[model samples]
Target chain A: MISPVKVWRNQKKIQKILGLYGIIVSWTKVHVPPVGFSSQAPYVIVVVKLESGKSYIAQLVDWSENSLKTGQKVKAVLRRTKNPGEEGVIPYGVKFKPV
Target chain B: MKISVLGAATTKFGELWSRSPRDLVMEAVNEALDDSKEISLQDIEAVYVGNMLSGTLGGQDHLGAFFAEELGLHVPAMKVEGACASGGLAIHAGVTAVSSGIYENVLVVGIEKMTDFKPEEVAEALMGAGSDPERDAGASFPSLYALMARVHMEKYGTTEEDMAAVAVKNHYHASLNSHAQFTFPVTMEKVMESPVVSSPLKLLDCSPISDGAAAVILSSKIKKTGRNIFIVGSAVATDSLGLAERDDLTTIYAAKEAARKAYKMSGVGPNEIDVAEVHDCFTIAEIIAMEDLGFFGKGEAARAVRLGQTRLGGRPVINTSGGLKACGHPVGATGVKQVVEIYRQLKGIAGKKQVKGAKLGLTHNVGGSGATAVVNILKG
Candidate 1:
C-alpha cells in the first residue's frame, strides 16, 4: 500500500500534468504486472513526449490497437494508479488517453 | 590495474529452495578461498557484499556485517547496492581498495534469494531500481525492456524471431553449463511460441528469478603467476532511471559510456575481447548491449545474433555461461557471476564453456532500464 502522506504530496505534481497533450514515442503492453497492479494487467504503457517539452511514462487508458502506435496523440487524464488494498489511500495519478 | 582476481567461485543458479543466504554465502566464499590456495578467510582485510532484495523480500539488511559475522570475520565490511549492478559495483569497490593501496586483499560477494517470495512480490521489489513514474504505471521489468524491443522492431525491422534466436543460442550454451538454471537447449520455435510476459518479449526472453551467490577474492599482494588473472579496467556510468527520459530508446547510454571508459583504460578495443559476459536480462537488452559495447554497429546486433555471430564458435563469443537468460539471474549475483565466469575463462579452467586462447575478456552489468552500467576488463 502507498503511504497516504506520499500520495498526498504527489497530488500537486499530478495536478500540474493533468489534461496535458502529448505524442507517443514508444509503447508496450504489460501482460504481467507487479503487485498492486494485477487488476490492471495487460495494460498499455507509453513513453509520451509532452507539449511542455518534458517526457512522461504512464498507462495508456481507453486505448485501441489503432491508438497504440508511435506519434499517436494523447492527453493526460486522472485515474487510480493501482488498487490500494484494504484501508489504504486511493492514490490517483496521470494516465494518457487517445486525444 | 595492479589488482588481480586471486580466486572466484559461484553457487548453482536456480530456485535453490534448500539454501539460505547464509548457506549460499558460506559455500561460495569458502570455495573461492579454496580456489586461491594462497589466501584464506583470515587474509581478507575487508568485505564488500552486493545484494539487491534482501531487505525488501527477506526483511534483512546490513548484509556486509551479517556475512562478515557468518564468515567469522571482524574486518571492516559494508553492503553495496546499485540495483542489479550491485555485484559489479562491489567488485569495483574491491578493485578501488586494493589499487588505492588501502588494503592488499579483499573479499567481494554478490548474492540474492528470490524464490522465497511470490512472483508479483519479487517483481514489485525489482522495480526499486526503476523510476517512481514507471512503478506508478505498473511497469514490471519485462515491460520496461519490451518497450525497447518494440522501438527496435519498428526502426530496424527486427523480428520476434531475431529475439527468439537469442534465447535459443543462450539456452544452447546453458546446456553445456552444469551450474545453469536451464541445462537443456531450447528450440527457436519453442521460444517464439512461449507465452508473452510483455508484447515482443516472450517468457523465454526474460531471465528466471533465481537464488545464488558468487564470490571473488581481489588482491594486489598476489604474485604474478602464469595463470594469474589481472583486472585491466573497471568503470561505471549512470543515466536516467526511466526509459522515457532517455534520448534514444535503442541504446543504453550508460552502457555505452561505461564500455568506452573500460576500453580506453584497458587499451583493448572491442576486437581484442576474445570472450564477454554481457548483461542479458532481456533478449533486447543483449542486442542493445552489443551495439552499445561497440561489438556491433547500431541496428546490427539483432541480425548478427540471429546469424550465430555471438555463439560459442563465433568471434568474441558472448554469454558462454548461458547469460542471465539461461544461467538464471539472481539479481545481485549476476554481476559477480559474470566476473567469476570471465575469471574462470582467463584462468583456462572454464571447462566445456571455455573460449580458446581467451587472452582478454569483458563483463557488462546493468541496473534498472539503463540507469547504471558497470564494465570490467580482464587479462589472462
Candidate 2:
C-alpha cells in the first residue's frame, strides 16, 4: 500500500528516467515475490547501466529469453510498479524493455 | 581492544511457535549470566537489544526498555537496528561503551520472532532492509542474491553444483550441532532437486525464517584467570542500499572493508584465523563472503568450498555451527549467534562441532544485499 503523495512525488522523478537507453549489467528471474507483487510472479529484473552513465534496477518488461542476457540493449518505460488495493494509490515506476 | 566477552549463550534455533519473544530473551539472558559465573544480572550496568521486525511485524518498539524491565534490571538500555546486522552492531555498541570507560559490564541480546507471520509477510518485512526501488521492482532477498550469483557464474564459471556444495557442507556441520534448526544432513542431490525460489537459487540455498535469541556479556573487568577471551577487533562498514548503485556485483565492498579494518585492528590476517562463523544468509552469500573476507581470492571461493578447504579438519574451519543455512537465520539473532558460536569454539566447549586447538576466531555479519557489514575478531 503506497502513500498517494509519495507515489505522486515519485512519478515526477520517474519521468526523467523514462525512455532512456541502457545496457544490461546483470539479470535474474524472481520466482517468489513479496506482498503487493504476487501478481507479477516470475518476473525478470535487470541491472541496467544507462547511456548517461547512471545505473538503475527495474523489471525487464516485454522481454524474451534472448533479451535476458548481459549487455543486451534496453530502453526504460513507465509501468505500474505494484497493484494498489481497493482505494489505494496505484504506484507507477520505471521498467525496461528490449530495445 | 580492552573489551572481553565474559559469557555467551543462545537458545535453540527454529520455528519456536510456543515461545514468545520475552520467553526467548529470558532463556538466553539467564543462561548467559549462568555461563559467566563471576558476573550476575546486577553486574550489568547497561543493556543493548538488537532486533529488526518487532515494530513492523509485532507492532512493538522500545525493545531496550522492554527487555530491561523484563529482566528486572534498572539500567540504561537501548535498541540497535542495522537490518540483519543488528546483533553485530549491538555487540559493537557494547564494545564501544566498555572501551569508552562508560561501563564495566554490559549485556547485549539479539532476538527475533519470525514464525508468527505468513511467509509472504515475512518476506515483505525483510525487504525493509533494502531500498524502496528494489521493493517496487519485486526483488526479494533470493532474487537479489540470484542476480549476484548469475554474475559470479558468468565471470568465474561458477556452477549451481558449486553453490550446492555449500549447503551440503553446512547441513553436514548442522548435523553435529544440537541447537541447529535442521539437525539432519542434506545431500547434493536433495539440494539440487529443491524448488527454485529464484533462478540458480533453490529452497535449500536460502536460510529459513526462524525464531530465537542470543545473548553475550561484555566486560572490561578481566579476571586474573588465564582463559579470558578478548575482542581483538571490531569494525563495520556500509555501502549503497541497492545493488544497482554498486560498482561491482561479484564482491561486497562493505564486507571487504569491514574485514580489512577488523584484521588490521586485531593484527591478524585471514590465514591466522583458526575458525570462523560467516554470514551465509544464502549459499551465494557464503561464497561471496569467503572472497570478501579474504579467505579466498576473487573467483576462487567457490572452487575452494567445493574442494572442502573450509570444512572441519580443514584449515580455518568455517561455519562449524552449521551457519545460517542449517543453523536457522532468526535475522536479528543471527549476528549474535555467530559470536556465541565462536565464543564456544574459543572456550573449547563447542562439543562435536569444535575446531581442534582453535585459538582465534572471526564472525562476519551482513545486512541487506551488501549494504552493511560487521566483522569481529576474537582470541582466547
Candidate 3:
C-alpha cells in the first residue's frame, strides 16, 4: 500500500506536472491514490540508491514522516540495532539530507 | 592425508511410515555395512550423526548417542549441525577422524524427519534457521528467499525466467533419479505458472520439506577395488549471521570462502572440475552460488543454465540428484546425499544421471541463507 509519505509526494509531483500542462483539472490519475491491501507491520524495507554508487536496504522507522517517499533521494547511515536486544545494527532508514 | 568413502546409503526421500528415527538410521547403517563388507562395524571406531530439527521434527533429541546405541556400536558418537548442511559437515568430521589417526574407520549419517510436523509448522521451524528472526520480525523461509530473488533481480538483472530455469533443470534431473523427492520433469512454463509462495519465489522454486536419511562410511585404508574416491579437499566457512550484514545480498560469502579454500587445497580451478552437486534449496540460491563458486562469471550463471551447459552431458553437471529444490531437502541428509551422488558419478555408477568420464567431482552444501557452508572436492 502507498504510505502517506508517498501520497504527499505524489500530490506534489502531480501538482507540478499539472502546472506544466497549463490546465487546472480535477484530480487526475497521477494524483495520490489509495493503496491496496497491505500488512500493518511496524517495520518496512526500503531500498535506497545513493549518489556514491552504493545501495542499502533499510528499515523505515517513522511511518508518518512526509519525506519518506518513493523516488526521493536520501542519505543512509549504518546503525547498530533496529530494536532493543537486536543482534546487530544495520542501515535502519534513510532521510532527506538538508541542501 | 587420504580419506576414502567406502560406501553410502540413503532412504527414499519422502514420508516414511513404519520407520522411526532409530529405524531410519539403522536401515541406512545396515545398507552401509552391507556395502562395506571388507570393513564392518568392528572396523568402525566412531560414528557422527547429522540431524536438524529432530527434536521439533521427530520428537527425538540426543540423537548421536541414540544412533550409536541402535547400531550396537560402543564407539564414541557425536552429532553435528549446520541447518541443511548438517550431513555434509558431519561427513567432513568423519573424514577428519579417519585421516587424523583417531580412527581407522568412521560412519557419518545424515537424516531428517520432516513429515512429523504439519506443513505450516515445518515452515515455521525451518524459518528459524535464517537471520530474519531478528530483522523481518516473522518472515518465513519463502519470504527470505523472495527477498533474495528481488535483490538479485534488482542488482544483477536476474529475471523470474532465470530463477524458474533452475527448477526446470533440477526437476528434469530429478525425473531420472529413482530416489528423488520429486520424480517428474517440469517445463519453464510449468514453473512460471506454479502458485506463488512469496512474491517472485514460486512454489516450484522452493524445495520440498521431506523426511529421509543418507549415510556414508569413511576409511583411511585404501580399498583393493581401486574404486574408492579420495577426498582431495574439504573446507567449511561461516558468514555474517545477518543477511543485512553482507556486502552484497546476491552473493553467499560462506559459499565463496569454502569454495575458495576447497579449490586451493585441491589445486583445481572451477573450470577443471568435471561435475558438481551444488545446494539448490531455492532457485535464486543456485543462480547466486554458480557465480560465488566460480562456476561462471557474475551474472553469467543464468546464461550458462539457459544454454544447457550444466545438464548431465554438459560442461559441468550440477545437481544431478535433483537438488533440494526437487529432490526433497531432508535438511540433515542433503549434504551427504550430494556427496553420495558425486561418489556414484565418479565411480561411473550413476546410471542415467552420470556425467561421462567424471574423474573429478565436487559438492557444495549451504546451511541457512549462507550462514554456514561446506565444499568438498573428490577424485577417483
Candidate 4:
C-alpha cells in the first residue's frame, strides 16, 4: 500500500506535499521505540514532502549524514523492516531515498 | 455559585521511589487540610482525584474510593483523567461541584507516579495518551513536537536556539523553586548541545518523568479568615487526539478555546493576567501555548520569549513555579500544582520567583498534544 503521505497527497488539498523530487521537511535518528510499530531499533526517520506538498513520515534508506539533510531532494521507495514480527511476517512499506 | 480554594499543597516533585501513589496523595491532602484546620474533615463532602496512569503505571484503579478509604473519609470520590490535563480537569470538576452547591467542601487532587518504569515502558504508557492507528505509529513522543519545531522554523523562521531558550528560561525558574524536580540552571549552550531525542528537540526540551502529587481543598462554607483565593473562571476543551489530524501543526486550538471561555467568564483579558502557569510538557508546547493563549502572535512566541518577554517581570511572568518543564510534571498533579503556584503568587507569597502583587492569574493545562486543554482564571 502507498504511504499515508501518498494517500493524503492523493487528496485534492495536498496534491503537492510531493514535489518533482520530494523534499525532507524534518529528519531524526530515533533511538526510542513505540515510535514506529515495526521499527526494530535506532533508525533514521524522515517526514518527506511529496511533489504534491503532502508530508509523510517514513524510514530513511541509505541512511547517513551525507544522505539526508533538511530540504534535500528525495523520492519514495518501498522497503522491508529490519525486524520481523514474532510470527516471522516481514512488513514492507514506504521509505525515502536520496535523489 | 462561588468556590474558594481554602488551601493548597504539593509534595516535592521527583522520584519518590519509596512513595506509593496513595502515600503521595495522602501527603498532599494532609498538608492542604493542615493549612486550613478551620474546615473539618467531616465538612469535605466529596473528593475528585485526577490521575493519568495509575491503573497502568501503578496497577491501581478506583483511585477515588481508594484515596477516600485510605483517608477514612466516606464521601463520594471519583477519578478524572485527561492525559496530562487530568489534574486541571479534576480542579474544574471539584470547583463546579462546590459552586453547584452539591458539596460544601471539596478536595481536588492530581497525582502521577511515573519513575518506576523503564524508558521504553514509560514510552509505551505515554503512548496511551495519543490515538491509535494515527499518532501511535511507533514514533517517539519527542518526534511529534520535533516535527512541530521544524515546521515552525520552516514556516516562521523560529530557530533551534529559540526552542532551547525555553529550556534555559524554565531551568532558571526551577532553580528558585524549592520543590522543583530539577532546580539546577542550564545554559542555552547546554540545552542546544544536549543529545537529540528527536531532530530539533533535545533531552533538555522534555519534561522529566516525575513522581509527585498536589492537592487543593475547596470550600464554600469555610470562613474567609486569611487570603481567599477564588476560582472566578474555569473552562476545558478537547481536540483531535492525533496531531496529524489537525489542519495546522503550529497551534493548539483547544487551549485557545478554553482560554477564550475562561477569559470571558473571568472578565479578564490576557493582558490583564498578572501571572500564568502554562503546560510546558515540551519546550515547543510553551511557545505554541503563548500563541494559543493570546500572549503572542501566531509565530511570535519564540521571538517574544527570546526577548525576555515571558520572564519574571516581563510580559505576564509565565510559569513562575518552573512549570512542568523544570518544576516536574506529575501528570494528574500538574493542574493542581499550577494552581498552587498561582495561589502563592496571588497571595504575594511566591518569594523570589513571585510576580509581586499579582492579583489575577491563569493556569493553562493541555493533555496529550492538544487533545484536551483546561484554562482557569483565579483572583485574590
Candidate 5:
C-alpha cells in the first residue's frame, strides 16, 4: 500500500547568511569523532552569532593559531561536509572563516 | 507521610573493565542492603532505576524490570531517563512514592556502563543529550559546554585559568575519596597545559566516563532507626532542549528554577546550606551551577572558587566526593552517588573529607545541557 509522504513546511524559513559578518560565541577544537560521526582532528568548531541577530553552530575554515577568539569577526561560507551515507553524496552547510 | 533516606551505597566509581551494568547494580544493592539492614528486599515495594544510553550502549531497555528480576524481586519496576539527571530523577520518584503513602519502602538505583563501547562510540552515545542540529553537525558533548564556556568568558571576563582551577580543586578533593576515579591531585599548570578538548575547556576540565552504580532506600518507617536523614526538599525543572531555542544561553533556567523551588520547599537559603554536591560535568558547569543555585551572584562562582570558598572546609564544601570530574560520572548513577556522599557526611562516617559539622546538605543534578535540573535537600 502506498502512503502519502510528508514534506517539511520550512515555515521557520532559515535565512542562510553567507558572507555575513558574525562573532564567535563559543568554540571547541574537535579532536575526535563524535559517535558515528568522523572528523579531521583539531578542527575549530564554533557557534557564530550573525549580524542578523541570529546564532548558528558551524565549523571554522581557514583557521590559524590564535585566529579565533570570542569576539573575533568572521564570515560564513557555504561549505561541503563528508558524505553522510555513501556514493560521495555530500551536503553543503555554512562554515565560518576568520575575516 | 514523610520521606527519608534509610540507606545508601555506591560502587567504587571508575573505569571498571571487569564489570557490566548488572554487576555494578548488584554491587551497590548489596552494599546498601548491608548498610541498612532494616529494609530488606521483600520490604521494597517497588523500584525506580535510573539509566541513560543503556539502550544504545548496553543494547538494553526495560531496565527497571530487568533490574528487579535480576535481583529476584517481585514488584513494579521501571527505568527513568533524564539525560545526566536520571539518578536524581529516580530518587525524586522514590521520594514521591514514600511521601504520598503509596509505599512504605521504596528503592532507587542509578547505573551506567559506559566502557562497554569504544571511545568514539561512547562519545556518540553521549551526544544524545545535545541538540539535533548541533549533534548532527558533529558537535561533541564537550563542544556544547565549550560554547557555554566561551560565552561566559566573553560576558564576565572569566579566564581559562579560572576554568583550570576547578580541576585543581576537584582533584584535591578526589585525593581524599577512595571511590574516586582519578585520585591523583592535578595541578593548575597541568590542567591548563592539557590537550584541549574544546578551546577554553581542556581534557582535564571534563568528567571521565566510567562504569558504576549507586542505590538508596527511601522509607517512611523512620521511627525504627534512632537516627535519620530527612529528605527536606526535592524539585525538578526543565528548559528548552536545544540551546538555540533558549532566550538566554549564559544561564541555565532549569537549574535556577529548580534550585529556587528546592530552597523554598526546604525553607533553607543558600547561606544555610552546609555542604553540596553539584553536577560538574565540566568545570564551567560547576561555576554556572553554583551561581544558579544561589550560592553566589551571577558570574561570581569563579571568584568564589579563587577565594577558596568552595573548598572542603570552605564555605559549603561543594563536591566533597570530587565531583564528576574526579569521582567519575557514571551518568545515571551520579545523582544517587551524590546522595550517598551527603548521607555519609551527615552520618559523620565520611572519613577524611567530612565537613566539620555539616547538618544540611544539598544535591544538584542536571541533565543534558541544562534541559533538566533536579535539586534535593537533606537535613540531619
Candidate 6:
C-alpha cells in the first residue's frame, strides 16, 4: 500500500511515480468478525518487502470480494477513496499484476 | 421556589495568556458581581465553586481555598465536583443554599486551567476522572467514546455522515457565537475529510481541550424592579459509573431520569423547551443526548441533525452557543457556561443565535457519559 503522505501530497504525482515503476494495485474487501459492518468498506492488510529485506504492514482500503490470492505482486497508487474533505488513500489492497 | 439569575459571567473559553486559574475565576466573578444590581460581596452569605481537575490538571490542591483568598471573601467557600458536570452542580448547590432560606444570595463559580499541562498529559488526566484508576490505566477517553460510537452504529444504524453532519452544524452555529473556542464554520465534507482521531469519529467531532472559568450569581430574593431569568426546576441524578455495569452503551440513563424530574418540577415537556445546551464532548454524545433528553425519538436524533431540524430556526434549537463541540469545555466551567447560554437565549440577548419567543430553556450536563447528570430548566 502507498503511504498517506504520498496519497495526500500529490495524487497525480504519486500515480506518475508508481507508473514509472510498473506497479498496479486495486482495492479489495476483507472481513474480520465481532464488530458489525462499516460504511468505510472492507480493508486489505498488506506486507511490503523493501531493499532492507524486511517486510512491514502496508496500508489497507475497502475493496470488493474475490480479487486477490495468497501470493501476488502489485504497485500502489494514490487516489481519492472516500470523502472529498479527507486525505487520499494508500490502499494496500490495490494491486496489479507484476510484469 | 423559583431562583432568579441576577447576574452571569464567564471568562474566555480557551487557553489564557497570562492568567492563573484563580485569575480566571476572579474575572468571571467580578463580571457577575458587576451585573448584579444591588448585590455585594458582603451580601453573599455562602459560596460554591466547581472544579473538575485541579490536582491532576494543574497540580493544585484545596483549589477553593486559593480562589476564595483571591476574592477576599472570608465566607464559607467549598468546591463541588461531578466530573464534567462540576459547574452545574455548583450552581445547584448555590440554588439550594439560597432557596432553603439558609442564605439569601449565593455565588457559584466554575474554574479550570488546563493549558499548563501538555495535551497528552491533559487527556490522560481527564480520562482518569471516568474510571477506577486501575481500570482506565490502558484506555483513554476517546477510546471509551469510540466504543460507544461502534455500539451506536450497530444498535441504531447511525452513520458516520450523521456524526459529521453534527460537527458541521455545531461549527456553523459556533461561528455566530463570539465566545466560542472554534468560531469557524465546518462542512460535512470538511468534518469527514479531517483526520480520524478514532474510528467513525474525527477531529471535528471532538471538543478541544481548554482553560477557562464561568460564574453565575443565583438569588432567592426576587428583585423589586429589575429583570432576571429564573430557574424553575433543577434536578440531578446518578447512574452506574462503570460502563460495563450499565444496561446499555448507546444511551445515558441518568440524564433521562434527571430530565424527567426537571420537567416534572418545571411543569414543562420536551416540546416546551425553546432551547437547550447539552454536553457534546463528542458528536455522538450529542446525538445520544437528544434521544436521552426526550428532544427526539430514540434512534432519530441523527436524522434530526441531518435535516437541519436542530439548527437555530428549527423546532428546538440545540447548542446555539456552539456547545462543547465548538465552545471550549473547560471542565468545571462547562455546566454553568451551558446555563449562561440558556439564560442569554431566554432573555433575548443571544445576538445572532437567539431563538424567537424563547420563554423556556434547559441545560443538560452529564459527567463521564452516564455516571453523573444535572438537568436544569429556566424561564424568563
Evaluate candidate 3 and give its CAPRI docking class based on DockQ.
Answer: incorrect
Model 4 over residues B327-378: C-alpha lDDT tens digits?
Answer: 9988999999999889889878788898877988999999987899999999
State the lDDT of candidate 1 residue by residue for B148-240, as single tens digits. Answer: 999899998889999989899999999999999999999988998899898879999999999999999999976544478989999999999
Q: CA shift at A41, candidate 6, in angstroms? A: 22
TM-score-better candidate, 2 vs 4 = 2
Give TM-scores of chain A for all candidates.
0.95, 0.95, 0.35, 0.65, 0.75, 0.35
Writing each residue's lDDT as its tens digit, candidate 3 over B19-117 gives 777788778888877776677787878889998898766677888888888888788998899888898899889977877887888999999988877
Q: What TM-score goes with each of the models?
A: 0.99, 0.99, 0.82, 0.88, 0.92, 0.79
| Residue B357 lDDT (model 5) | 86
lDDT of each: 0.93, 0.93, 0.74, 0.82, 0.85, 0.74
RMSD of each: 1.0, 0.9, 9.6, 4.6, 3.2, 13.2
Model 3: residues with Cα > 4 Å off, grouped in runs = A1-99, B132-136
**Considering summed lDDT, which 10 consecutive residues are worst modelled in model 5 chain B?**
B130-139
- For model 6, the interface Cα RMSD in angstroms equals 15.4
Which should have the higher DockQ, number 2 or number 6?
Answer: 2
Give the local distance difference test score of model 2: 0.93
Q: After best superposition, candidate 1 residue B139: deviation in angstroms?
A: 0.3
Give fnat (model 6).
0.00
RMSD versus native structure for model 4: 4.6
Quote the positional error of residue B10 for candidate 5 in Å: 0.1
Candidate 5 stretches with Cα past 4 Å from truth are A1-22, A50-53, A62-67, A71-78, A86-94, A97-99
> Which residue pairs in candidate 5 collide?
A35-B124
Which regions of candidate 4 are displaced past 4 Å? A1-27, A35-41, A44-99, B134-136
Better of 1 and 3 by TM-score: 1
